[model samples]
Target: MQTEKVTQHIINWLKNYALNARVNGFVVGVSGGVDSAVVSTLCAETGLEVLCLEMPIHQAASHVNRAQEHISQLKKRYKNVRDAKTDLTPVFEEFKTEVSLEGEQAIVDMALANTRARLRMTTLYYYAGLHKLLVAGTGNKVEDFGVGFYTKYGDGGVDLSPIADLMKSEVYKIGEYLKVPGSILKAAPTDGLFGDDRSDEDQIGASYPELEWAMQVYNEGKTEEDFTGRKQEVFKIYKRYNRANKHKMIPIPICEIPKNLK
Candidate 1:
C-alpha cells in the first residue's frame, strides 16, 4: 500500500482503539527521526490528544534540537500537541554506577544507550498512567520486528505500535505525505545513543533497505535466495535476537498441572 494510505489506516485504527479503551490520549517518543515523526503526525491527524517527549542523553544534542523544531511545527499544525523534554544524562550516570559497569568503552556505551531508551519508556509510561493515555510505539518493521534492533525492555516495550509494519523507506514516504518538516524527513536516522559518529545502520552493519528486502524474502519463505550476500549474517542476527529475547515476546512460562487435578 502507499505510505499515505497506510498512515491513514493506522490513524483510524489507533483512534478507534483509543476511544474503545477509554484512553484520554496518545503518548509518543520523538527522536527527531522519520519514523517517530510520521507516527506523531498520524496521531495528530486522528484528532486524539498527542504528547511528544524529547528524551536526550549527553550525545544527542543535535537530534534533540531537531526534535524540538519538529514539535514546534506540530504544535502549529495540530490542535492538541503537548510536549516535554528531559535530559537523560543524570539517569544514565546513576544507572551506570548502580550497575557497577566496568568494561570496555563499547560495552559501556551500549549499556548507556539501553539506559536512555528505558528512561524514555519510563517517562512515557508515567505520564500515560497519570493522564490515562496509551503509549504509541514508533518502531518500524525493518528495525524492531525484523531484526529486533530495539533494546528488549527499553524501546521494545510499549502499549501499542501504530507503525510496526511499515519499513524505513515507507516511513520516509509517510513523513513526506504528512508534510513533516523537510529537514526531519531527510535527516539520517539514528538512535542517538552514541555520539554523531555512531548510527543505527553503522552499528547493525546493514542498511534498512537491504534488511527490509531480506525480511520480505524471508517472510515469503525464500530463505535460500542470496539477495543481499549477507543472508547468513542476517539470519544469525535474527536468530540471536529471537532466542535471547524470547521472554520479551512471549508469556511467562509456568509449570503445567494435570487437567484432572483441576
Candidate 2:
C-alpha cells in the first residue's frame, strides 16, 4: 500500500472530519499499543488540538511506561499535542465494591476487565465533551471487524475510527512510519484490560497475523473445512469470534412497527 499516500490521506480525512463537525480536535485513549500509538500520531498530524489521555486501571507497569513514553514523544514533536494521566484504579476499586461479584470466576473476571475499558471510554468522552473534541477510536480492522476483540460500549464506543479499515499489519507499518516509540512497537499486542501480561493472542487463541490471514480467506468464501491442521484451527477460532461478536459489528437492531399499527 502506498504508505506515504495512505498516511496523508488519513491525516486529511481527520482534519476534514473535525472541521466539518466543528470540533476543536480529537481525544484519544493511548494504551501503549500499536493501534493507539498510530492513531494518536495520526490525530496529531492533523495539526489540531490532540489530547492523549492515559487512563489506567490496574494496568501493567510495562504498558503504563510505554504509554507515557509515546505520549511524551508525541508532545515533544507536536506543539498541538498534550497529555493527561488519570489513574482510574481507585474508581475501579470503588465500583467493584458497589457491584455484586457473584458469578462464575472466569465470567466475573471477564466482566471486570471490560469494565476497565468502559471506564477509559467514559474518561475519554468526558474530556471530549469538556473541550469540544471528538473521541477518536484506536481500533484496527482485525479487532474492529474480523475478531471483535474489543468491548462493546467500552473500547468500541467512539465518535470516529481513523484506523478501523487498516489491518493490524498495516497499523504496524504506519506506526513505524510515524516513528512511534520503540518500546510500544516491540511490546506484545494486548488489550491491557486484564491488568496482566496476557497478550491478545492468549485471549483469542490466535495472533494478529493468523487472524488477518483467516479474515482474508473467510472473506473470499473460504471455510474451516477447506483448511487442514493449524489453518483449520485458526479459521475456526476466527469464525467463532466473528459469529459471536456480530452484534458489535452491526448497527443496533430495532423492531419495526407495522404500518397499520402506526
Candidate 3:
C-alpha cells in the first residue's frame, strides 16, 4: 500500500463525511492498538476536532499507559485533538450483576466481556451526541471480516469504519508513517476487553500474518488444501471463524412480504 496516498485518502474521506453529515468533529475509542493509533491520527490530520476516549473497564495498566502515550502524542501534534480517560468498570460490574440476576447462573465470559464493549460504545456515542461528532471505528479488515472477533452491536457499532478495508498488517504500515509511538506500534494487538491480557492472536488461534494469508486463500476461492499438520489446521480454523461470524459480518436477514399477501 502507498502509505502517504492511503493516509491522505482516509483524511479526505473523514473530512468529506463530516462535511456532508454536518458534524463538526469525530469521536474515536482508542484501545492503544495500531488500528486506533493510525485511525485517530488520520482523523487529526483532517484538521477537524477529534475526541479520543481512553475507556478502561478493569483494564491493564500497560494498556492504559499505551493509550495515554498515544493520546499525549496526538495532542501535542494536533491542536484539534482532545482526549480523556473514563473507567467503566463500576458500570460494567453493575450491568453484569443485573444480567446475571435475571438468570440463576452467572454471566458467561463472552457475555460479560461483550458488556464492557457495549458500555464503551455507549460512552463514545454519548460524547458524539453531545458534541455532534461521528463515532469512528477502529476495526481492521482481518478481524472485522476474517474471524468476526468483535462483539455485535458493541465495538462493531460505529458511524463509519475508516480502516475496515485495510488488513491488520497494513494498519501497522500506516502507523509507522504516522509516527505512532514505538511502544504501541510494537506491542501486540488486543481488544483490552477482558481481565486477562490475552493478545488478539491468543484468541484467534494464529498470528495476524498467518490469518491474513488464510483470509486471502479463502477470498480467492482456493479451498482445496491439505489439513494434516499445524499450518493446515490454521487454515481450517480460519474457515470456521469465517463461517461462524458470517452473521455479524453481514446484514441481518429481513422478512419479505409476498405481493399477493399485500
Candidate 4:
C-alpha cells in the first residue's frame, strides 16, 4: 500500500476504535523513535485530542530532545495535539533503592530498566484516564510480534496499537510521508531502556533491515536452507531472539476446563 493510504487507514482505524469504545481521544507515549513519531502524528491526524507525552526516566538527552522537537512540530501543525512531559528519574531512583541488595547490582539495574518502562506505562494510563482517551501504542510489526523487543505489560501494554502491523522500514516510509522531522528520521532508533545509551541495533545483533529480511525468509519457510556469512548470521540471530521472546508475543496459557466439569 502507498504511504498516504496506509496513513489514512491507520487514522481511520484509530477513530473507529475510539468511537466504538466511547473514548474521546488518544494518549500516546512519544519515545522519539520513528514508530512513536509516526504513531503520534497519525493520532493527531484523526482530528481528536491527542496527548503526546514525553515521560523520560533518565533517558538519553538526545532521545528526549528528539521527542520534544517532534511534539513541538505536532503542536504547531495540529491544534488538537497536547504536549505533556513527566520526568520519572526520582521514581526510578526510589524503586532502585527499594530493590537493591548486596552483590546484585547488575540484577538491580536490569530489573530497574524494565521498571522504567512499566512506570512510563502507568504515567500514560494516568493521563489517558484523566482525559478519557485510549492509550495508543507505538510498536511496529517486527518489534511487536516478530522479535518481541518491548517490555511486557510495559510498552507492550496498551489499549490499542496504530503501527503494530507495519514493519520498521514501513514505519519510516509513513513517517517520511507524514513529514517527520529530518533529524528524527535520520536518528538511530533506541528504546531508551539501558543507561549505556545503546541503540536498538546494538542490542538486537542485527539491523532493522536485516531483521526484516530474516522475518520474511522465516515466514516463507526458508529456515532450513542454510547459507554462510551475514545471511546465515542474521538467520541465527533471528531464530534466537524470536524463540527467546516467544512468550512475550503469545497469550498467556490457561488450563482448559474438562468437558465433564463444564
On TM-score, the leading prediction is: 2
Runs with alpha carbons beyond 4 Å of true place in candidate 1:
195-197, 224-262
The models' CA-based lDDT, in order, is 0.80, 0.95, 0.89, 0.89
Stretches > 4 Å off in candidate 2:
none
Model 3 per-residue lDDT tens digits across residues 139-226? 9998888989898989899999999999888899999999999999889889888876799888887989989988998888876374
lDDT of 1 at 149: 79
lDDT of 3 at 153: 86
Candidate 4: misplaced stretches above 4 Å? 101-107
Better of 2 and 4 by lDDT: 2
**Residue-level lDDT tens digits of model 2 in 180-216:** 9888888999999988899999999999999999999
Across 1-262, the per-residue lDDT of candidate 1 in tens digits comes to 6765777788899999999999987988898888888888899998989999887777666687778889999999999989987777787777777786778988877777777888888988988998899989988887766777787768887988888878888888888889988888767778876756366777777777767866776777765435445776775555555456556655668999999999
Q: What value does the lDDT take at residue 126 in candidate 2?
A: 94
Top lDDT hit: 2
Q: Candidate 1 has which clashing residue pairs, if any?
A: none
Model 3 lDDT-worst window of ten: 98-107
Ten contiguous residues minimizing lDDT sum, candidate 4: 99-108
Give Cα distance to truth, residue 162, candidate 2, Å. 0.4
RMSD of each: 2.5, 0.6, 1.8, 1.5
